[model samples]
Target: MFDQDKDTGGLQGKVILITGGTSGLGAQCVLRLALNNASHIYFTGRNTKKGSAIIKETHDAGCTTPLTFVECDLTKLASVKAAADKILSEQHRLDLLMANAGVMNQPPGLTADGYEVQFGTNFLSHALLIQKFLPLMDKTAELPGSDVRIVQLTSTGFRGAPSGGIRFDDLKTVQNFRVLGGMMRYGQSKLAAVLYAQELARRHPNIISVSVTPGIVSTELVSKQNAFHRSTIWLSAKITQGRIYSPKEAPASQLWCAVGPRNEIKQGAFYEPVGILSKITTKYTQDEDLAWRLWDWTQSELKQWLD
Candidate 1:
């Protein structure tokens, strides 16, 4: 199931931008991209020390490639926009934009914008990112046989997430604040992630936009979660029929989405577990209304930055 040309060899000379590349799944993505000999890999994170260290690690891993680290606090919309603008100043083409930076199940926390931390970091931050990079994504195919990619990392808990539907009205969930509520809300955010990708691809036909479940790999994503959540990670590692992958395993599905050769897969399709891209689960795939509504609401929220 591995092709050198489609994934390994072809990755050379591609320019990829990944958010939250300093840790967890994002760190894995950095290593994979470096190994693939990508011409340039630009990633951002808030942890300055860790960010620098990861970049050094990429070079030390024998990438011998250019790695740029932008200090970005995704909690701040202004920061996200400014980072995108910076990239746009120097680069016109962004071959792969993996929205892999997301807060897993977290306790109640607030961002600089005063929005719920999970939704802001996981969904809205990414939404604003796509808006800013929308132009770059559309121009991917202009580079002659170049197919740019946008991969969103969602979760298996998407459908069952949230108390009742993805509440567009109460994204912050000020009315209720239970641990499970937040966890479900986090899933709701992931659900919105694919739905947002769906809406984006529908609007922009030039880019190959997709969402994938990274198959529950062990990473710092658990540390952001509760004890039970952390235990769930351990339990999955122990007893699951499928192999519980490490943080490194997190990026293969991502790199596949970015660089894998697939003959078919309609733009905006949601994929789960590796190169297996399918639009399963009617609860999510069938909800066009929810998707558009989410897009509209998110745009409205980020109107100032968009302006």
Candidate 2:
């Protein structure tokens, strides 16, 4: 039997980057990676106070893993570029890039770049970060036995997206914006994330590019919802058998994707719950044509900023 408590010890000396690492699942991932002795970690968030606290706690626990906090507001593309540039300047290679920062349902709004809130934060910003960091990841992959990886944090909420999938025409929700449409919008963003990972894996066979869902975890994700929405979720959970994982348990799948045996997990696969390979519950997620279309659309969207 595989020892559930055994340490595999793979992250030592690795340089890792995690977005939205200030709290929740991202924070858990940071702790795990640090405990495994990653040489350096660059985590992005807007809260310096919280970031400092996480850093202090890690050091207090006798972890020598150097942690650097980059103040990145994922809602702003400019901030994303600045954070990526800072990492590029300091690190010759990034062994792992976990695009873990995301927001759930929120009142209709636009990002600093005018994209929908959920789509911009959960998908587009992450897409840009991966593009900016690919050169460094590719350089690291050239090393023998190096597991240079890009892990996108997706969710089961993706199953809630529209049947046709990825409303490319109205990603901004300009035509039909509903206050309660946040759930579907969140799902769409996550689906885009999965497709982005699939397309990336196809384009770059040498590196590991995959998305993962942690299942439902009890976290601050629910705190943002209004009272009615929150109550509805609580009631729905009671109606169905919903497994809510703890923060520690939630990050396990992503941690596995980041450092587990490369041969055990396929590139571009959508992994779920405690490190198992599982396809998302949607054919659109695996649609190669749709994946390429998303890729092309994303590239064109980022062209102005990328240039």
Candidate 3:
């Protein structure tokens, strides 16, 4: 289920950063990357205890990779910047970035940066982090055989996004505000992940930027849902007996895109089902103009963090 013994020369000496690495799929990526010999693995999360446990778990498993923790609260742009700055100070090169931190359906609210919570935490902050860390990434680009990659963990929820995609005017307002609105907002953010990856790949040909859907994994993501949605899932599970992937399986597509052969991945692509270049069936997700508009809007809104 993992490339435990595969030669990791491709990842040797590489510095990797993964957000939301305290639990779930992000945790799996951290361990797997450590096993594969990433020289420095820095994972971000708000929970210091969980962070310490993850570090210890790796060591107990005989992981020799250098592991560090960067305390980051994704809902706050300032926190994200502080974490990035810490990495910039310590790591000379950032070989891979896993934009894996995100929130699912939640009550309407603003991030510390004042944007919608889901959109802000899931997409906006990550977009800024990529911008903030580009210099470090580019430094690695100068090295021979270096594969600088950014993998955005989008979701199947993207297909259910709102009618016109991102609501540019009402970025702060949640129309319904609860279950329905929360899902729509979550979808919008996930769609942004897909579009962001696409636009990033197009703009930076030297680096790899791609999004992947991990396919309905059984994790805390579902546990965050309201009771109504939970009941629906329970009933659906009883009737269809559907396949809910394990947390270990959830990071497969992401790891594949992150460490797979260069030629196998199509740059600017969204992947799914372990490892395949599946197209984003959503029309809005594939809109180049919309992607650029979102990028520009994010930059304009986050001008203070651009430095």
Q: Report the lDDT tens digits of candidate 1 across residue range 38-102.
A: 77889989998998899788778787878898888888988998998898888878888889888
Q: Local distance difference test, per candidate?
A: 0.78, 0.84, 0.84
TM-score of 1: 0.91
Alpha-carbon RMSD, each predicted model:
2.4, 2.1, 2.3
Off by over 4 Å in 1: 3-6, 172-179, 233-241, 278-282
84-108, model 3: which lDDT tens digit per residue? 8888989789999999988888788
- Each candidate structure's TM-score, on Cα atoms with residue i matched to residue i, is 0.91, 0.93, 0.93
Kindly report which residue stretches of model 3 are placed more than 4 angstroms away from their true locations once superposed: 1-9, 175-179, 231-242
Residue 118: error of model 3 in Å? 0.4
TM-score of candidate 2 relative to the true fold: 0.93
